[model samples]
Target: MIPRYTTPEMGEVWADTTRFGRWLEIELLATEAHAALGVVPDADAVACRERAPQTDAAFVAAVSERERITDHDVAAFVDVVQAAIGAPAGSWIHYGLTSSDVVDTALCLAMRDAGRLLVSAADTLIATVTDLATTHRDTVMIGRTHGIHAEPTTFGAKAALWALQLDRDRTRLRTATETVAVCKLSGAVGTYSNVEPAVEHHVAEALGLTAVPATQVIARDRHAELLYACASTAATCELIAVELRHLQRTEVGEVLEGFKPGQKGSSAMPHKRNPISAETISGLARVVRSNLLAALQDVALWHERDISHSSVERIIVPDSTTLVHYCLQRLNRLLGGLVVNVDRMRDNLWSSRGLVFSQPVLLALVAAGRSRDDAYRIVQRNALRSWEEGVDFRQLLENDADVTLTPQQLDEAFDLARSVRNIDRVFSELHSMASR
Candidate 1:
């Protein structure tokens, strides 16, 4: 992943240093596991662990040089670690384990840590949206159907929908993390020819992963699931980004991302405060989504396994995780610092001269014994007249002979509060999901 899209913490996790360090740790642990089976002496396992950190820059350079000849990355890594410890202790470094054993398990560890950060970011966004929903529970706005005002609704209802979606995002990430947290030490063909299933079980327990039943690698489907979850979460963030972009439009001006002091929206335009962060999240979401398609393509490989998936995983896994983390973090900040224009929302609510309240008025007339079609026509005609002639829908309905509703009934129909009478129930539902 590029620095522009990657956060430092996530970027560091996938750094060569961190990756090699984990590889070294896995090698040492495998040696320890083998020692327990009397495959190596306890002294050698301890010595390997003690000297494991010494596989530093010079050692990696030497081993990478060896890979130029051996043409195997894991084989070179093992040779390097063995050279660091020397003689008998070095001999037990990668005993009874394959490259995927170390590589897949260590990848799980990185993903576990990344999942924690992503969930935290999602929770932060959910909290901000929840707070916004509660604060604007009665703040009315015109709800649109086909880019035109269709009905009345509170801004809180819109925010509550976002909150509910984020709750689902958290659930999806949890499932993805669990699915990918699997370990395999079954060796080449997964028949446990050299290493026993018990060794795999123990190694999985040691690394806080579940033992996979059988694997050429730890099942590419698991990786696919994880990438899809990450991309899907980013897609949801894009939904919010789109909404924020729409609301921040000059014509709308109903909501805006917080404009920081000293921040510039344009190079030369003096009066500009754009929703750049929201737009940023939206833009980066495309990268995450594109990476997920690559992960899906990785699912089908040559029987047992193939290295084709390996190279792609090297790019998609770290890039997708890091990109999603950056997006979630930025979206959290955007939601938390959102500047909602309640007065503008209220003003826009009446922009169509109470035409947004047409549906309720139509329904009320139908309940008063008018045919549904007749009620709809009456409401539609009055609404179109109000929009074009700047007359109030309610006043027109009151004067139209075709309309049968009483003044009291018209008053009830025009009530936006009545339209959102279930707001509290919706909020309660959002809170319940948030608690989970």
Candidate 2:
């Protein structure tokens, strides 16, 4: 992912230093496990541990320099670490282990940490959206369907729906994190031909991961699931962004993204306050979704294990995680400072005259001894006139003798309160979920 859409914390999780550091940790843990099993001498394991080089810039550069010659990253890393440990103990550094043993385990560690950051950002976003929802619970607005006014709804109700989706996204992130929190040290053929199963278990436990049965590499299905979860979360962010962008449209003007004092919406236009944040989120979501396709493709590699997934993972894993983390944080800020135009919302709600209350009016006529079809025809006639001529629907109905409804009945039918009377019920459900 580019720096523009990457958070520093998430970027660091995939950094060379962090990757190499995890590799070294896995090696040391495996060495200790071997020593416990009496496969490697205790003294050699201690020397290997105590003499291991610090995984800093120097170490990373050395590994890169070695990789150029070996043309194998894991092999080069092993060579570099062996030299740093030196002598008799250095030979035991990666004994009874294949590249996947260390590489896959280290990848899991990185993913676990990166996932934590994403989940935390999602938590903050959920809170921000919930706050907005609660604050706007009674802030009435028009609901649109297919770009046409449908009925009255509160901004809070819309925000509450978003909050609920975000909550689901958070759950998905956590589930994906656990799905990938697994280590496989079954050797080149996954049969543990040389490395004992106990050694794998010890290292996995030390790293707070589970040792799972696998081939040379951990199954790509696990990776695919993680990527799918990220893509799903990104899609949720895009969902919210798209709605916000629609609300912020010039014609609508019901909501606006927060604009910093000096921020310019356009280089040429001074009167614009564009929803750039939401637009950015919607755009980045496509990238994450594309990455997920790549991950799914990775699941069908050649035979038990192959490097076909390796190069793709190097890009997709970090990019997806980083992009999602960035999107979530950006959305949080966007919602936290969102500018809701309550008066504009109210005005927009009635922009179609009284046509929004057509359904209620139709039902009222039906209750007044009219056939359902007859009631619908009566309501549609007046609703169309109100829509086309900019006349109040109720007045149009009152003037139509076939309407067959008394004034009191008409008043009860067009009541806006009836449209949102159950809004409190929705909030009650939301509050109950929050408590749990």
Candidate 3:
């Protein structure tokens, strides 16, 4: 992945040094696996392990430069290791192994590390959202449907939805990574025609991977699943971000992303304090989704394998992981520093002039023996009047001729806080959360 889309740790995951290091590790492990099964000299395996690390940054750079002439990345990498070990041991370096054996296995190693990071980032985001949810669980606000206030809700309930989704997203990424973490050293075309099946299993186990029955490659479906996992996580972050953006809008200033003292929202408009971080996460999410499409296309290949998927994987794998990691990390920070106005939320909740209570009022009317349609018509008539005249809805309902309810019933109907009184029950299962 490019620096623009990558954090330093994630950048290191896709770095040349990191890439060649895994290749060398797998090559050495495979050599020992062969030796353990009496297929290769034990001395050769030891010597190769000892020398492979000596092929450092300069050596990896030279091998990368050599790739232009060979037009083979794995071969260039093998050449560097072979040269470092020399003679008889060099001969044992990549014996009975095809390019995909090293490339795919090394990719698994890198992905395993990257997956752990992504899962951790997700966990942190979930925890942060949980904290916010617990704190604001009782803070009432007007919930919207299709850009119109629909009913009363608590800000904590909204955060709880995000926290639960991110917990699932964390699990999804972890599962997808495991699916992609399998190693395949079954020689070319993956029949173990050249290398024994035991050798593949032995090497895979040593590398902390499970070898799968495969084609020339480890199959693109696993890779596709990993991409989809990242896209799903990105989509979740975007959902949270989109909501934050709406909440931060000038007309609906119920919540806001942190604004540093030196931060500037707009060059011309001094009053502008935009939701830049949320907008950025939403933009990056689109890229993650598009990458999943490319990965899905990679699932179909020419016969045993093809290079078409290889090129795409090289870009999408790291890019998708890095992008999702960034979104997760940034969202956690943004939420931690979030400025939530309890007063503003209350103001917005009542801004609809008590019409947010219409549903409860309608239901109360229906429960009192009126037909559903008749109750709805009566409620909608008063609700519309409140909308047009800015009159309180409860007052309109109280004055209606058809309304036989006493002041007590109207109090239950118009009480916005009453609607969210039981919200703490929703967080009961989340004991690790602040379930106040």
> Top TM-score: which candidate number?
2
- Tens digits of lDDT, candidate 2, 174-196: 99999999998878989999999
Judged by lDDT, which candidate is best? 2
What local distance difference test score does each model get? 0.85, 0.91, 0.88
Tens digits of lDDT, candidate 1, 14-33: 87777888788777767788
Model 3 Cα lDDT, one tens digit per residue, 44-79: 888887776554689778898889889888888787
Q: Which stretches of candidate 2 lie over 4 Å from their true place?
A: none
Task: Report the lDDT of model 3 for residue 140.
Answer: 83
What's the number of clashes in each of the models?
0, 0, 0
TM-score each candidate: 0.96, 0.98, 0.96
Better of 2 and 3 by lDDT: 2
Candidate 3: segments with Cα more than 4 A from true spot: 53-55, 432-436
RMSD of each: 1.6, 1.0, 1.9
